[model samples]
Target: MIFAYNKAHVGDVLMILVKNDNGADVTSTRCGNVTKIALKETNEVVAWNIFQASEMLGEISGVGQVVLSDEQIALLNEELAKEGFREVITQEKNSKFVIGFVKELTPHPDSDHLNIAQVEVDNGEMLQIVAGAPNIEQGQLVVVAKVGAMMPNGLVIWDGELRGVKSSGMMCSPRELQLENAPDVRGILVLEEGSATIGEAFSPEKHWHG
Candidate 1:
């Protein structure tokens, strides 16, 4: 789940992103000050727009990617109920950016440059990623941006396929992470051995600088 609020630019509204519609057509339904956006065909809710949000949830501070507390989530549910909407929002507590260990790498059968990687991100949680970084190698410690990560450029990572291969996450480059003094070149950022614990959240402030 992602929440965003910018009173000055977007008015006193709260934007809640529940899921991506994958460019599918959508329909919007409004009840009171709340608007629910859903897929037109399946009616699966994808997002919500709450007008006058500050009046109910108090003033939210931030222009993008605002973090809400558990209390705030409950309040949002209450508001949804009041508006006769059955959908409920939940808080996502896990970090989407973390360190990963590449356990295996193989050439993609359908792609010339892309390589399929079996990466161990969390304890016993392996993800198949398609990386094109020429410098990528097995046994490397690298940054992994899992599905649902919101990049610095406002791009939301989602489960995707590459060249007929299923890829669950991304091997991030310094440029993709918007790191300070990122190299003007191609290749994923490789972390030094013992630099960080596998599966731990990656903090650029502590790990990288110009």
Candidate 2:
């Protein structure tokens, strides 16, 4: 469940998302006044009071209209973590992607163009990733979308297999990272030597911040 501010409310108000469990709104009991919102072909309920009428998105767990502070969001994540539900942050304050060093590279057995790379991300762990770009080479510094990262274009990184190789994450290109002034070139984006640390977050927004 996630919390958000209801835009319709003129005053401060907080809304909590209660995921649909077993095709029923799980949090309807907490919100006394039940507002049953149709989730397309699903039986889910958005139980709340004084919310502006709107459509329901089936994929999202829940979004409340109540805005929360950074401290409040942290507290909520901690509380929710105790319940075995993944922590959900309502705001995007930090970049989930990071810079990485390509520690090793090897040719894929089945594909001549595909390469299996060992990339060391921050946290002292090496991630096995399958890369196809011809420019990628060992010892190069590149951007890595760590598992669970959400790319700017809405692609979520997850564990998967490419051909026959098990890949834990992705080596990103400039367009994939959605950087401003991104070069119109092919292959992955390679950072300059000493430009960034192996595990530093890729935060292009920092360049524009005072």
Candidate 3:
């Protein structure tokens, strides 16, 4: 689930994206201030538009992909119940960007330039990521943008396939992270030894001028 609010550009509305519709036909049903967007074929809820969101959720401040607290999710559920929608909101608590240690690396079967990597984040949790950075190597500590991350350019990361292989996340470069003074070159950002603990959230502020 992804929640975004941009009062300056989008007004007092909260946009919720629950699932990708995959270009399927969709329908919107509005009840009061809540509009449920669903896939027409299966009637699966895919997104939502909550108008006057601040009045109900209280002071939602963010440009994109705002994380919702459990309390706020409960409030949203209450509103959904009032409108008779059966879906309930759930809080996704994982950090979108984190430090990852590349545990394995191998050549992609179908793509010569792409590589398949097994990155470890969140202690023992592992993610299969396909990367194209020339500098990517096994046993390196790099930044991993997990599924559901909103990049600096407003791109949302999602589970995808690269060259017929499933990829769950991304290996980021400084340029992609929008770090200040990022080198005008191509490669994944490699962290110095002991600079950060594996699985910890990656703070862009620390690397703005690094």
Candidate 4:
């Protein structure tokens, strides 16, 4: 759910939309098979509902299921936070992805570019992961795919080794997660600075085509 201000238009009123008829007066854009909830007074849209699998049009932001562990919901009210607003959503109780912090990074003994990293998936556990991304570094917040996670490309993550270095999980890429405007390069996806909480889930809406 979104708690954003009307970015398209400055308005003092709030528009509540639950059904199609409730938003009849506004111009709804087509996003996949779903309808975007744009405001009548302006182009401000805070959310959408996915109905089918299809390519999206224009620059519509996607929404995913998320649960806030703290009362930092006020961060969503910040002006800068509105631009390309995204969330690390967890779709279910047993989520497959989670926020992780890179605790340490050491060179792989057998590989030139590979690094053996100690990542903190939660407060107590430290996962030893072998990552090949050049951008993987210490003190960065990232999404970690646990074993059994079914990636968007249908690759199920499993505990494995890189150059004989055992890796418990994997750091994710935006392309693997199917996020919009994901960088078409070889690098692990890093969350925005200070945007993620340790151990928070990272399961975005799979049906989002935006």
TM-score quality measure for candidate 3: 0.92
Q: List runs of model 4 lying over 4 Å from the truth.
A: 1-92, 203-210
In candidate 1, position 88 carries an lDDT of 86
Per-model TM-score on C-alpha atoms: 0.93, 0.60, 0.92, 0.53
List pairs with backbone clashes in candidate 1.
none
Ranking the candidates on lDDT from highest down gives 1, 3, 2, 4
- Each prediction's whole-model lDDT (CA): 0.89, 0.63, 0.89, 0.60
Off by over 4 Å in 3: 206-209
lDDT of 3 by residue, 57-171 (tens): 8988567879877778889999999999989888678788999999999999988899999999986999999999999989999999998788878788888888789999899
In angstroms, the error of model 4 at 209 is: 14
- Candidate 4 on 1-210: residue-level lDDT in tens? 321123245322122222223334566655334445656776565344333111211222322222333222233223113433342212233566888899999999998989999999887689999998989989998899876565665455667778788888889888878888777998887877677787888845522223
Task: Tell me how far candidate 1 lies from the true structure as C-alpha RMSD in angstroms.
Answer: 1.6
RMSD of each predicted structure: 1.6, 8.8, 1.6, 16.0
> lDDT tens string, model 2, 84-147?
4442435544454788999999999999899999999987789999999989999998888876
Query: Which ranges in model 2 have alpha carbons more than 4 Å from their true place?
Result: 1-70, 74-95, 205-210
Q: What's the C-alpha lDDT at position 198 in model 2?
A: 81
Number of the predicted model whose TM-score against the real structure is largest: 1
